[model samples]
Target: MTDNQGAWTLGCYGNPDIRTPNINQMAAEGIRFTHALSSNPVCSPTRATFLTGLIPSQHGVHSFLDPKYMMGPEAYNTLQEFTSLGEVLHAAGYTCGLSGKWHLGANMTPSEGFTTWTTKPDGSTQEFYDQKVIENGQMRVEAGYTTDFWTRKGIEFIQACKERPFFLFLAYNGPYSLGKLMLNEARNRHAAFYADKPLHSFPRDAMHPWQHDNKAFHNTDAARRRMASEVSGVDDGVGEILTALKANGLDDNTLVVYASDQGWMGGQNGMWGMGDHFRPIGAHELMMQIPFIFRQPGAIPPGQTCDALVSNYDFMPSVLAHLGLGDKMPQQPKSPGRDFSPALRGQPLAGWDNTVFYEMETTRAIRTERWKYVARIPSGPTELYDMQADPQERFNLFGQPGTEETTTDLSKELEAFFDEYADPKYDIWHGGGSKAKRHAP
Candidate 1:
């Protein structure tokens, strides 16, 4: 999994300029999901959902975890109360390992049943080269690039655990183009190739009116090149991972999933970063859509693309069912995810729901096949868009003549869904607190 990368940045996703041969090939050799979305739009909350199959309200992580509480004395495991993907897989006799960002908290040591851990000490990245990493329960500044470091550790874990059933969460913290890191040109191996390229993939639109962060580097040439270089760097790591799997003779049996924790915006709709970059914490399509690819020879058919609407919360359940561990899914908390394992095997889902939802602190949204509704807690700036007629979302239909019924229906559905799944202790709409920091109004 990658950090802050949208599917739009890859070649298979229709970016003509970016060199993502490995990822594109992976999509060709497996199942690619065109409508895979993140339940939340930040790092920690969405990562929690991906692992626990629970939304922010159920998992209690509303936003990116603070560095102070991620390590040191205050550090605590954020997902301790839930049965996470690692825990379930480990319980099923799989050797679980994690490499790269563990922004869920307690970065000082492994959590959620992972035995082999190599991760960054903090969630945010100020620099890629020579960053602080925790390996073997010891902190040290890695001499090489952090992306490569994670990839090497992942490959090593694979080689070491190849004899047994293993589950390696190779989380890459790359293409994170939102902070001081974007101010400087990329210094990785892909730097020279991107230095002069226009990289039209990253838009140079006027700044979004609600954009409040990373203002200076929003549309700069240097930022675009840096973003492109980092994406290509991640692509290089993907190539290495695939080669290692094949070289170790573990490609056919192992299920390799390529995805991002959440989506990112590269000047889309004039927005420059993630959902939190907007003042009201937007839930635009570009901020929710992520690249989701699943590969396993003789299991999932190759060159198939599924456009079924799915969310990150659906991942854990699907993988568990696919691995014949459907009986192990947590039943007490009742995860709001359905098993999409049929779609993974290139089979048609008879009654797959065509809807997904999102939440970011005070903001909540519901998206269907033809419409999108965004609502804020205890306020009046709700929005309704006819996605089929206005895909750009340039016009608002809320309070308009023909949209009242649609708006009412969607609003009630959104509330009902959350009311059924949200834990009252962590439900922000009910005046509950979050485990991590929040961007609440």
Candidate 2:
């Protein structure tokens, strides 16, 4: 979840058929959001939204921005501008710690409220690599698997602040291997487990034509296997963190959250990765829908599921509400996301709108309880699908007869949503650099 590295291939939610036990166990014990999504489809934008509880338009981080954008005058001042969730928690008398990928700004130090911090440099491999920690304005490097290292740092923070409440953001970069070593391991495992069936056969209910393209994966059965293995590895890491929390006696009071930055395509739509929306071999559920689970024992009932639509943008506000500091937090002027803590507790969310808005560069989508509207900007060719009927989003019903009223209504909703929530300046700036300019009408 740290980097925009291998999001698509790792099955950010879960390959139900592939059966990741760790993820499955978590789903069984906690709530699983089937309609959760990131505010943006890429790395930096999504991270920014989660940290600040604002939309990308409000944050002016429509895409990945490097140090130049972070520091330069014309580039956009990301640092020293937006308030982070860490800062909010720190303000409310909670010690904060962050471990894992910090792609928001180049510097690893807590830029917000992390009393303790450890992070890997951007573009690093997903292996257990050396980490650079920033403590009291000082930097130090240590060696370990990235996931394990983050968990260790988090446990240390919990021990150090046993009396005082704390907030730990343990992000991981797993199941997203760039090289073939991990991929081969996954493939071998799959071959051994599912050797009787053809590895690349399309799912029976596959809605997208691209899902059947064997040539897209070409020679990547090993890659698929590796992806599955890495996901299992991440699940193991999550289990370890959960065990540590319970062992430390913090599980009862502490709120634990598990989610991915975004979904990955992973050869499900004839594509191996994400961030290629222009060519868009796949942006179906496999590439966008993410898995979100929160466990706050006693506070949030065990084994509860809420279908209320949510996204990363709601993360900060939700956390602030959980800490009883929602009143003190500054109102996010441009964020449409509301706190979902009540809904998570199995209480009916009165007036709760079940719509999640999503955008990635020129691509924009609005998912309601039953319908989905997706548009690729600059060309204005929109896609409309009834999720209840076709969750895969294969059939485009724009300009079709008898559905004109539905299309008009949804398009109007999307337009108003964009007008009020979307940032035109960021769109104009970032959309020009995008490879695809076609807009969904």
Candidate 3:
């Protein structure tokens, strides 16, 4: 995200439905993990995991910050509790810079590992055209779309930092939440996208923000088209960045990590809005499974696909190991995410557990090779799906007789996984009690 940039479709994510050539090219040039999970299906928390290699429960940010603080310096200060990848890489002599979609923390000052920062402070909280950005704390509206603006700025950082190794965390806020923010408005509008079906057909009322901005989008074809356009724009930006890398001769050495903090639900699962009590959380596969692509010239074999379980939390450790700085980085005891660098290089780690655990408030899920078991705290309506048999998840085999043993086993493993990393104060499943408990301010 940065906003609601969902993986609507790309040939790589088993969706031969929509076209995303630039991203698809990256997949062809690297390894694509079929089962990459997001720690949480939201913006800030998942972004936090990228830097800490820990899920939101361990990193402290459980939900996206309130609008009053999402862009201010307070958000940055709030994230100081964890040791960031920036501090780790910056300490190792890497020039760190960030451009675009700085929703993880305070967007104003150059904090964290980035000494160079550019973002949307001058512009209102959404959109891609004629926008203003605060560059290194100074406000200025650049003459371009936001995605293009970030691509240029990222290229600038790459060209300027030729003297040293650099880590450019370029995040774009796009398909602008809901895919209907014109070329501008980029706030809650981003999450308004829905599949090209009747919104009324779903089981529940759409949790759209203000009737999807009072538009007749209501799960119309127009909404999907707008979302597709926004994704196309992001693809163009990706092309530009890869071109810039080739132009600057940094293509061979730099390791490219293409991933998303989380995914959005476009009218799937009887809900339009994402979860954590907003709708459904950790219940549908769409929200947790994100696009994970890795590209490195000779280190990782190109055009290969890996099915081992991976998640956003594992990125930090994998990146450090890939750069040969694994031993140098300090460990976060609360984080249970493992480094998949060996898997990326075509060597699966010894004793690799091919499973991933997920939670948002009281909603919990554990996904393995064939099963995806989802449960809630003190609950009813638990779901057990045979992912191998029914990828669409149309059937719930939870309480069925033949599936009882499998469901019970998954429940035990899910609890054990959370118990290992649960910090009562921050973990939504543990300290926060249940989903209903998250309704408070």
Top-TM-score candidate index: 1
Q: Write the residue-wise lDDT of candidate 3 on 238-310 in tens digits.
A: 7788888888888888888777767766666544535542433445777777778888888888898888888
Off by over 4 Å in 3: 1-3, 71-76, 122-125, 179-218, 269-273, 276-282, 432-441
Superior by TM-score: candidate 1 or candidate 2:
1
Best by lDDT: 1
C-alpha RMSD in Å of predicted model 2 compared with the true structure: 4.8
Ranking by TM-score: 1, 3, 2
Comparing 1 with 2 on lDDT, the higher-scoring candidate is 1
Separately for all candidates shown, the number of backbone clashes (residues 3 or more apart, or on different chains) is 0, 20, 14
Q: For model 2, where is the 10-residue window of minimal lDDT?
A: 432-441
lDDT of 1 by residue, 1-441 (tens): 999999999999999888999999999999999999998889999999999889999989999998878988888999998889999999999999999998988998888989999998888888899889999999999989998999999999999999999999999888888788897989998899988998888877888798888898877888888888999999999999999999999999989999999998888778888889888788888889999999999999999999999999999999999999998998868899999999888889889899999998899999999999999978847889998899778788999998888999999999999999999999999998899877757
- Cα lDDT of model 1 overall? 0.91
C-alpha TM-score for every candidate: 0.99, 0.82, 0.86
Q: Pick out the ten consecutive residues of candidate 3 with the lowest summed lDDT.
A: 183-192
Per-residue lDDT of 391 in model 1? 78
lDDT of each: 0.91, 0.62, 0.70
